[model samples]
Target: MGIVLNQSLKNTVITYLGFGIGAINTLYLYPVFLGATYYAVTNYILSAANVIMPLFAIGMQNTLVKFYSQCKTEEERGRFLSFTVLFPFLLCIPIGIIGLFFFDDLVYFVSKKNPVVQTFIWLIPFTGLCMAYFEIFYAWARVHMHSVFGNFIKEVGLRLFSLFAIVGVYFNWISIVDFVYVTSGIYFLALIVTMLYAFKIKRPNFQFYIPANVKDILEYTFYIILSGSVANLLLDGDKLMLNQYLVIENIAYYSVATYIALVISVPSRAMHQIVYPITAKLMHENKYEELNALYKKTSINLQIVGGFVMLCIFVNISQLYEIVPKEYSGGIIVVFMIGLSKYFDLILGNNNAIIFNSKYYRTVLFLGLFLVLITIVLNRIFIPLYGIMGCAFATLLSITLYSLAKLLFVVKRMHLYPFTKETVTSLIVTAVLFLAFYFWEFPLYPLIGIALKSIILTAVYLYVNYKLVISKEINDIIDKMLLKFKLRS
Candidate 1:
């Protein structure tokens, strides 16, 4: 927990900083500089690429995390690392060949409804391959307990670069089309730097000497591919479906709402970087008691942090939307629905690491596949009727069911649950703060109002959570910061 706390805090700061930059881009720059159509096109290309990223890497990222620690010797570890790198190419090559052969057909199918996508269709796989390897190497860093630097690159570096590129567009240094290319290139740059850092951590010996558990490795990798696809599909499939059903421009609006909601998930994403490898280690060593304790600790702590983020977003959602283009304001409902779904998942803590590393992972994969099917079906049914809001409804419903299933599966199979009395306490705190501050907006500028409310909310929220001691870890962090401030003064 000490190492987890230290690294998780750093990652959280880094993740939020990234999201801060992303908010500026999504809310202001993309809409102001690129306008609706190109903004939609940029988002669509990235989402489409993200949906296929799991297939391209063939789950090597997760496979690396799950299996890397099992290697007894450095030579053995090197061999496994080598295996992670080369194995993905086996599938990638054949897929690339097929994609190239049918490139025209692929373009026609993807761009049939919205031809703006036709020109950018080629970037999807290119960007997907880059994203795939970046995760693979990023896992390489995580397995060695060197997640912060990789996370900085992932959470901060990528967005920072995109900021520069978007600014270039605004300055007439690059056209919108050039911005699209720069966006894909930024992903490529992320992959390269992550690979370099991963190598610096443990220079790969580049041996194909397969581990004795090659069979188990392959089987896990296969299941991971399917499971990873399900996870990615759940996140990005909405955008892809939007591209299919609505004019490509609507995706920009939906992206804005989703970005605002995405801030709520930052704690989970940050914690997962350090927590996944640790969770895998615990499961590997059969530390059931420790694992269960971790489960509860992460659950409550994330709920407190994520609940704060949710409150900030939901309470100020109207103001946040006010700052964005009027066309994007239609997504207010989208934020609440999607934000609620993310909050549910956030309170589950390291539930994903538990399931993915557990023996019952295969069973959960089936559940995930079912959830994906439900998502597609729900989107198909709802998109035509309600448009963007319907897509949000479909997503909210699909994710809730999926999250609930995973919770039940963990409870039933492992007898480990993330909830404690603190769970209810955290929720109550969030609910109270939301109700109190939501309708009490200040009669000031939207930005200033958001700032003032956030300050008041933060002070009050932290004081209550500290008084109740919802998470000792969190309370300790607060106490330490206060002590530092007092000493500095």
Candidate 2:
């Protein structure tokens, strides 16, 4: 437990630091240098690529994680990796052929009103293929418990490359069309680097196995594809829908707000990376008690961390928007709404991981499909009426319902609940801190206002936690750090 906590904390710090750099690049630098329309085009293209990548992947990224752990020998695992890599290319060719046939119609349908977006639609399939291979190789790396490098490449490396491309565009070294192509090229380069690293660690040997095991893999992959598609739709579908139904510049505004809100999920993302493998191993061994304890602890810790992040965003949202163009200030409401959705997701802890690794996974997929339909309907009804705010509302409603459904499913099927006294305490304290900082405005300068609000919020939240003693783990960590420093002195 101690080791998991320490490593989880360390990894969370690194992931968020990387995400912080990404936020700056997305929110401030991109908008400041490039206009909102250009920025929105970039976001829409990337989001489209992400939404398409899973189709080409054929769910191999997830299948690798589940099946790789089941293999008894390294050679078998290597063969599985080889198959996973080859499978995507096969799926991609047919999809690419179909895309080529419908390319003009699809572009016309999605971006008819905005020709700039239409111009960039060609980048989607190329970037999608690159993204598919990147995940396939990344999963191969994760199976070996080497996640840090792959994460670096996925999270930081690609963003850093795009940052440079933006610089090139700013300096007039390349036209906007070339800039977009360069962004797609970055993913291809990242895929190449990850593949080289994967082979260097364990060279894959291709073998044609009997189609018996392949059948089972395909069935699992089918369920995972449905599940993954719904999940992506829930996460990024709002932006895509906004791009289609609303104005193009609204996509930029919504994206900025979404970026701020999505930061609350960083802890969950980092924890899930470590938790998925651990949960899979535990479930394999029938270690339900250990899994239950992990569920509770992760929920509480994530809520605490995620709560603080949401607090920061909510408190400074006004000042944050003031830095951007006035047109983007409308995103303030979107940020608040989406921040709540992410916080709800955090409170569910490892519910998604547990269900995905359990026998009830198929049932979970059905629920996700239902939610996807709901998300689509809600977005359609609201986006036409309210634009970005409507999209935010749709997301908030869909995510809340989805999280609740998963929570109930876990409790009913597994006879385990993640809520505890600490959970209640954390929620109350967070709510009070949020209310206190949200309504009370300081008369200081903008920067000073943010600093003071942050300080006050942190002090109040920590004091409440200290008074209630909500987390013995956090106290122990603080004690250990102080002890080590004292001994060194």
Candidate 3:
């Protein structure tokens, strides 16, 4: 937990800063500068790329983290890493050739309903390739226990680039059309920087020979690719589906809600980047007792922190939306549904990391495929009926069902659960705050009202949780910080 806390805190700060910048871009700059149609084009292109990235990387990122810790020698580990790097080309080369031949047909099918996306169809595979290599390189860093810099690059550096590019649009230095190209370049830039950093951390010693455990390694990567694909589709699939069923501008509306909801999940995302390898190592060492302890601590701590984020979002949502354009106001319910879904996923802790790194990952992979099917079906039924709110509903249902299945699998398979008295207390406190703040708002300006309301809500929420000692881990950290403050004073 020491290393987890140390790195998790740093990663959390970096991710939050990234999301802060992203909020400005999504809510203000993209809408104001690019307009809804172009904003939708940009969002759709990225979503399509992420959907394809799993196929491009062939799940080698997960393969690297799971196998690196199990290898016995430098040569053994190096050979394994070399295979992860080389094997993706086996998958990607075919994918690229298909894209080259069916480019027009694929674009026609995808953009049949909304044609704006046709112009940027090529960007999807190009950006997906960039994202695929970026994850592989970042996984390279994670195996060496140097995830902070990679996380910072992935989280902050990319968003900063987007900030500058969108600002260029604002200043008329770049047109919206050119900014699309710039977005693809930003992803490539981040990948190059991260690849260099990974080389500096642990330079790859490329070997032509395949590892002896190639069969098992290939099996795991195969299942992991589907599981990874399912996870990403849940994150981005709704936006893509919306592109098919609705006008381009509607994606802009739904994307804003989804972006706000995703901010609640950033803590989990940041923590997982470093924790995945550690969890894999624990599994390799068969450290069940320590593993169980880590599981519970992460669940409770994330629940506490994730609850705080949701509180700030829901309580301040009205004021927050007041400042954004009125067209986006309809997504208030969208934010709530998606935010709760992500919070539910957060409370499950490192369950995904545990399952994906464990032997039972193949089982979860099939379950994930089923969940993805269900998500698409739900979106199909709901989106046509309810529009943007329907997309939110489909996502919430998918993540909720997927999360419960993962939680039960971990509990049954490992005989370990992440809930305790603290979990219940956190839920009670969160629910009470949600109720109390639902009707409360200030007569002050929107910005001042949001600040004041957030301050009051967070102060009270912290005081209650601390007094209850809902999580000894969280309380101890808070106590240590307070003691340091007192000592300095």
Best by lDDT: 1
Better of 2 and 3 by TM-score: 2
- Name the 10 consecutive residues with the lowest summed lDDT in model 2: 1-10
lDDT of 1 by residue, 224-281 (tens): 8898898889889999999888899999999988988888897787678778988999
Cα miss at 329, model 2 (Å)?
0.5
The lDDT values for all models are 0.91, 0.84, 0.88
lDDT of 3 by residue, 1-489 (tens): 687678777888887887888888888888888888888899999998999899999999988998888899988988887888888877688878888898878889899999878888889989999999999999999888888898898888988899999989989999999999999999999999999999998877887668888898888788878877987898899999998888888999888888888889877876686678888999899998989988898899899999999999998898888877888898999999999999999998888889977888778889989998999999999999999999999989988998999898888889989898888889999998999997889999999999998999989998899899888878888889989889433
Candidates' TM-scores? 0.89, 0.91, 0.89
The per-prediction CA RMSD against the true structure, in angstroms, equals 3.3, 3.0, 3.2
Runs in model 1 lying further than 4 Å from the true structure: 1-10, 68-80, 140-146, 196-212, 270-294, 463-489
lDDT of 2 at 444: 73
Ranking by lDDT: 1, 3, 2
- Quality of model 1 by C-alpha lDDT: 0.91
Task: Tell me the deviation in Å of residue 37 in model 1.
Answer: 1.1
Q: Give a tens-digit lDDT track for model 2, residues 368-441.
A: 89999999999999999999999999999999999999999999999879999999889888887777788766
Cα lDDT for residue 158, model 2? Answer: 84
Off by over 4 Å in 3: 1-10, 68-83, 144-146, 199-209, 269-296, 487-489
